[model samples]
Target: MNTPILLLQCLFLVLLSGPLFAQRWTTTSQESEQQPLRLHGSLLFQGIYPGFRVGVERPIRQTDFQRSNGRVNSHQRAVLFYVGMYYHPGFHLNTFAGAEYIFRRVGGRGLITEFRSSLALSRTFLGAETYRVGEAGIVETVLASGQFYAMPGLGFGMGKVLGKPGSNRPFAYMVNLNLTGLAPYNGLALPTPTLEIGFRYQLATTSVHFRHRIRTRQ
Candidate 1:
């Protein structure tokens, strides 16, 4: 694919997403001051191919609710921006950076579930020797043979917040499984399954009370 065109398309999508997610948090009265920044760390795996990821998360909006059983629940929305690299050794080394829009629901006992949409750009480097044949039948060594790919993903995750809800815990964690696709891989998109076991650390000491929207079930 054309690199410039692909880049422009990616930028367009990202720009469009801002206002779309913004519409979900329209209650100005519920908005608080800037939220705490969270740090994230994870072990990434693709069927025994191992790597690590580090990133930061920013809170967007949160809504709390009360269930019919008197249990308090919450929905939190955030964006996670990250960069990571993985190596297949002798095959290829893939490095990528991306942003995910996360929608999380916190339930009883601090159990949490989430859905995410992601977009990234992947650059892969050839790990093995490459050569090209010239018109004169001379073979020339190709150095730094690689390609760029566009990666888009969708995923779901589940985990716990550790401690009571609203306790302002210093840490929370989750395990995620994602199906990510890379485009223009041999002229088509390649689907890959990945796993992430990660945690987020709250860096700020201040706390904010998220406004609750409650509805009683019949």
Candidate 2:
């Protein structure tokens, strides 16, 4: 099977499994109701090779804290699933699909800090035709030449929500820098660094809307 076909299959499975996965995070019958999912899109750059990423994220848990002086803050944990593709011009084109665990912190001012870890299936397609000499001395073209790999990554980001006073803002933005590792290349692991600037938009919520009430210092 071709990598493109595999990519599509994997993406389909991910989408189909989202609800099943969310079931494990439910703490009550009310929470079992369908929750709003966030949509994310980003412009990506890996050493000047431009790319794009799109993903869906669902928040599984969240906790709020308050300062002694009356400031309020919160942290959230969520699941993110994504797919992306990038071109290296005449070198190669790379495609990947992955899922990650997100740990994010929100401050009273709407500043956010995040950390994530991910795993993915990645395929790299050659830009030029590939040929190999058979043992019989005949040259043959290699069809759908490409390489497949398992990609693991760790990343961090900082951003802010667009609105807050009304506590009804549904948009947020972020910038991330990730270090991803690829293995089985020449029997050695390789590292790739990428940067992303992105936005997250909220979809319709369930019966209960999510909100945060900030307390002013006394």
Report, for every candidate in turn, its global Cα lDDT versus the true structure: 0.78, 0.78
What's model 1's TM-score?
A: 0.75
lDDT of 1 by residue, 166-193 (tens): 4235688989998887898899998867
lDDT of 2 at 68: 64
Worst 10 residues of 2 by lDDT: 25-34
lDDT for residue 182 in candidate 1, whole number 0-100: 82
Assess every candidate by TM-score.
Answer: 0.75, 0.75
Q: After superposition, how far is residue 168 of candidate 2 from its true place, in Å?
A: 7.3
Clash counts for the predictions, in order: 0, 0
